[model samples]
Target: MLLKQLSMSAILLYSSSAKSLDCAGLFKDAPTLVQGLKPFVAEIHPANVTFVPVGNPAYPDPVPDLPEFCRFGAEYNTSSTSKFRFEAWLPKSDHWNAFWFKVVLHLFELKIGNGGAAGGVDYREMAIPLAKYGFAVASTDTGHNG
Candidate 1:
């Protein structure tokens, strides 16, 4: 049984690695795909115009010389009134690694809270390190935004 499980794991890993997609190449070659995403892309103020202080206690220190990325939000609808929202950060061609990292945070302690509103300030902070490593990261608010 153990050997079988190991073999299955190896197969899955190999298949995933073999089929990795080059996101930057896809976007560049497919103009229609970029056009379709127009509605979902969020407009971000340039970092130079909207600066967060270095010593702010409420937020994590901003990443210095951060790579350029496209920020976008999407909704998944299961019903007229029920929907889920998520945000994605796609690093530009210069930094893209054709890999994705989804961020999931959970705190079991009673007093600490869930660490601020979902997809709020905390999510962006959490993505910095992953972005530095060239990952395309996505974060969801579970279903509702705070």
Candidate 2:
């Protein structure tokens, strides 16, 4: 059997001030956070950060009554040949419950004899339900770009 592994690492930040932060606002400020974490994070594409609203038409299974959130996407170069990609969903301050959710799905395709594929689509669907309950979610494609 072919084995594949998916791994992810994430960093979550909240404002020090008492002011509420919105999804769009967080997305706009994501670059600043990325820049500050340069020592730890290899690279963060500012252009990849985006706001995903409730019921985004782009998703096949649209989130119903989904809270507004910021989506941060990036690729990490840990080694010469290994690349890790991930996506983080942050709910607005007003919608947040101060909880962090990390979803990782390991799929084994017996028929195809493939293993270790990261099930990002499945985890993305899980985000909708978790967001409804006011949780921040982060998902990773491990290093395989699945």
Candidate 3:
């Protein structure tokens, strides 16, 4: 029983980590990316996904040197009239700084909190630089419309 449980754990870990992660491919292939996380996240459905390449000025505003990253947004439909949307930014798979990866051994995940009435995952200021360092950044509007 112990050995069986360990095997299952190993399988889960391996399956969750993308072997060939791609910025654009994530939009069509693995939109949600969240699995085994039920009740709270099972209802998540991809609503908007956009991948912006480096040097392209885009929505909200423009960052001087923002790296190419995947922008994903989803809605959690809890009821007929109750649904909230959130967004996430995943850095390029090549590991922005391969040298840093060789020393750090792993990437990092950063979560930004809602600020005042912003009501959106639009923290590009912080998200962009972290993404350049290969950090996975995520933020939510927290059900507000700002």
Candidate 1, position 119, lDDT? 37
Q: RMSD of each candidate? A: 10.5, 9.1, 10.8
Q: Write the per-residue lDDT of candidate 1 for residues 1-146, one digit (tens) a residue.
A: 22222322322232234333333333332224322221233433233233233322334445445455555444444356654444455555456665655553444311112244543324445356445687656554444442
Which of the two candidates, 1 or 2, achieves a greater lDDT against the reference? 2
- Which residue ranges in model 1 land beyond 4 Å of their true spot? 1-39, 43-65, 105-122
Poorest lDDT segment (10 consecutive residues) of candidate 2:
1-10
- Cα lDDT of model 3 by residue, 19-126, tens digit: 643434444433333432111221111222332323212225533445554454444544466544444444445643321111111134223334455554455544
Where does candidate 3 have its weakest 10-residue lDDT segment? 98-107
lDDT of each: 0.42, 0.44, 0.39
What residue pairs are clashing in model 3?
none
The model with the greater TM-score, 1 or 3, is 3
Residue 87 lDDT (model 1):
48
Query: Model 2, 1-146: lDDT tens per residue?
Result: 01112221224554323264444444455445544221222222222233233322223343344455555554556656765555566666677787665554434321111135633323345455445676756555555542
lDDT winner between 2 and 3, please give it: 2
Candidate 3 regions off by >4 Å? Answer: 1-16, 23-25, 28-59, 96-110
Query: What TM-score against the true fold does each predicted structure earn?
Result: 0.48, 0.54, 0.50
